[model samples]
Target: MIPDHNNRDAAATPPDALRVVPVEPSLHRALLRLRVRPAQRDRVGSMADLLADVTQCPGSEPMAIMRGDAPIGYYRIDASARSVAGRDFAQPARGLRSLFVDADWQGRGLGARAVALLLEDLAVRHPATRLLVLTVDCDNRAATRIYQRAGFVDGGARYHGGRCGPQQLLLRALP
Candidate 1:
């Protein structure tokens, strides 16, 4: 269990054995091969695209979701939601962007597990964060369902800027 950043008395549930690691030179080739399903290629951008954005986008941190020795998933956390989105986006919120599980790892429930672990770690790392946010293309029912089951609430905001157009914004409170 990881200790909460604000309250050391509390601990967030740790991933069974998965760890989210920072990007490293040695992992570049492996990380580059991680991809979502073919149909999802349009809805969800590639890891390469995320890497490009990470370079120009300040306050965005790219991370690799590692299980034992291999990277099973990839995601980014935006610390400056105010600057990326707007002030009304659940204040002091961290935006979860570009979350993707490898095509081979799908249907194993790893995505939700990864999200749970990531949120717990974020709570410890960002004590001031009151909420976590993410945007999903409305048609991506699978992704939406997993997030909702994980406690993300639909914020009723649609974004026209998504790759597939019209994205739904979801928000979750952090302890």
Candidate 2:
């Protein structure tokens, strides 16, 4: 099992205490199925496709949260020079491209734990990286709260048109 070094309280512990691990392509299909809401099924699938592409792309590495041998969620950490949320963060900086916990695993702190694990890994492996960024749907209050508690600050917002809701950019600066 991967070590839980994030200081996660037991009350906030994820069901089964999922351990975050390096994601493998073989688990991609399974990780794609993990989502908190049925309405987001298509979006989640698209995210999986993006993740697969990133995993194959040079200079990118992905990680997943797992329980025993089952994938519960996944996130990609990009080290390449790219702009997210209209801001050009430097290379070696990390961006949380996608993160989703299984519906059955919601409200147990699994999402928070997964993010904490990713940030911890980034801090060690890429100490010089200055920023960690992510985008959230404006309507996703729960996720916003989690991010806020995790030290992410609101950086900016982007309109995606229609009722899909605006996207809010959040960031956590690394020392």
Candidate 3:
């Protein structure tokens, strides 16, 4: 399990209280059941579709954001630099895709915590990844704020590659 060291009381909390782990065969079914709010359906898309995508895209890792033994969210790390930044990034980077907490588990600070855990996990899993890039829907202020608070910076340019319309391009340098 990945630890949530960003928390002030991280030492007080169990190391595995929240984390991101690869979607193993045993957790596939439960991970597929995770869903976002109705309004967010278009932003993140379905887990089945995203899972299938990871299989087709080489170096893409499908992961689950877990709280104890249950999956509360899901996301993918794409090692292909062109898959996300196009010509924006010129160095080794990873793309953060399909990140969302289950609707039932939202509004409890889990999303932010999950992102923090993901950054920590990436440092160990992909030591070569220096930059983390992602596109957040421009209208999704809540998610934008969360990403910003977690240290993702807006590049001030909109990425029009998303099916849900234009998205704000955000980047973060991984430690």
Candidate 4:
């Protein structure tokens, strides 16, 4: 069950007790400082680029992946699935973009937890959202594994022109 909004703690707490909150001006500076490993950049855009996308692109919102009071990572939700995947997903489908966990937080289940929280938040606030879609560099085995474990399945679409080379589309349908 989704936690009750009346209970702020429960509403803020997600899988593994990680707190996922909407990105606020107060957290932007800290979130911009969160970075993945040097090589992971090709797979995930930097927070600054993500912020710009949220601005230039409509129908997207920046989210902060927080651990306690500290901003630990970032993710963006794009209500217009077309923005990311260039396909006609259901009208309410959201593009899960720019998911990045700081290098120090990698391998600690942080990314998965952030995804869980985002899913719950969407279910609560955007009930019409039918699915979540993303594209990961096909060679990012670690991220692919994490998304697979979090219930995303290959959507059978591949792109050859991504900045990071071949990419595989993954989709997770919301219940």
Candidate 5:
């Protein structure tokens, strides 16, 4: 079982036992091809579109989680000068876009770790930013839980016409 860091003492043990590294482009594409549940097949296309857009955008940044030199997962952060979903999104507060790990790498807390890393990198790059926002499927309990663990709170907004049901807005403040 994964140790609960919140309840454990500082010297008790190291919180994360696994290593997560940034994703390389080739490995990122390869890892993305790994199948999730049959119902999630549509995620592949959506993720692909986001990746392409981020790649083409002049200011977007993408990060990957790796076990050593091999990529296991990746996520993207997109900055918009204007509001994205009716919220006043200005400089620094990047939108958390595509985030996915290889099917074989799920359930290892890599998702949370990957997000933590992404937030850390963003904080370093954009010191003035105070918020991170993302949209997940309302029905994706697993993804919601991961985001919550990473300090994201429900923003009470939704986007329609996504494959994974209505998108639920979530946001968190950076340290």
Candidate 6:
């Protein structure tokens, strides 16, 4: 079992065994056990709610970030721009949504690792996708930094459609 720690050290690196994979039946129970901290509830919402959103929305692909056979985080890639950015994208883009690390796994840099892998995975999975779009809440500076580090560029535009408040629409071109 992974040890629980409350301190979040951004510089920490993720384990080498980490892999981002689609959420399948065998991993469903483990993914359901993952949760973000209480303070992050509004930003990412509860796992149950996110799962429900994936189910109700067509073209939404739910993925799990795993270490061996255990899930450490979760996210979704939505083909519909409206479902992710709440607006039409200028080009062929996939929306990255509902990304979050489990509360027990927060400080380990797994989020960044998952993103790097996800981007690589996207190129192969979506050969025609020219861009990847996502909206980060304005107040979520940490998340913004992580995305920025992963090469997501911000255009200084605010998306006011988020449940918490205004969000920055960040974009990155996919290979």
**Candidate whose lDDT is highest:** 3
**Per-residue lDDT of 1-175 in model 4, one digit per residue for the tens?**
3233223666455444566677778887888888889898777777788787788877778887776667788888887888778988745688888888889989887887777777887787788888899998999898899899889999999978888899999999988
Evaluated at residue 82, the lDDT of candidate 1 is: 55
How much lDDT does each candidate structure score? 0.78, 0.70, 0.83, 0.80, 0.66, 0.81
lDDT of 3 by residue, 1-175 (tens): 3433334454565644887778887888898898888888888888888888888999898888887668899989988756876754767788888899999999999999989989988888898888999889888899999999999998777988777888988999876
lDDT string, candidate 6, 1-175, tens digits: 3321211332253554676777776777788899889888989887778788888988999988877658889999999767666677777988999898899988888888888988887877788998888999999998988999999999567888788899998998877
Q: Is candidate 2 or candidate 3 better by TM-score?
A: 3
Give every collision pair in model 3. none
Q: What is the Cα-based TM-score of model 6?
A: 0.87
Candidate 6 residue spans exceeding 4 A from truth: 1-16
lDDT of 5: 0.66
Q: Which clashing pairs does model 2 show?
A: none
Q: Report the CA-based lDDT of candidate 4 relative to the real structure.
A: 0.80
Error of model 5, residue 27, in angstroms = 4.9
- Model 4: residue 71 alpha-carbon error in angstroms: 0.8
RMSD (Å) of each candidate, 1 decimal: 4.6, 4.8, 3.6, 3.6, 6.6, 6.9
Alpha carbon deviation, residue 90, candidate 3 (Å): 2.9
TM-scores of all candidate predictions against the true structure: 0.85, 0.76, 0.88, 0.88, 0.75, 0.87
Per residue, candidate 5 scores C-alpha lDDT tens digits across 1-175 of 2222222342454443433333446555655564455565565445566567766876666665555445666676667523335466543566776677777788888888778767776766677878888888888898899999989998887888677678888888887
lDDT of 1 by residue, 1-175 (tens): 3222333443232434566766666777888889889898887678888788888888887788886557888988987665334555535788888888899989999999888878877877887998888888888899999999999998877788877878888889888
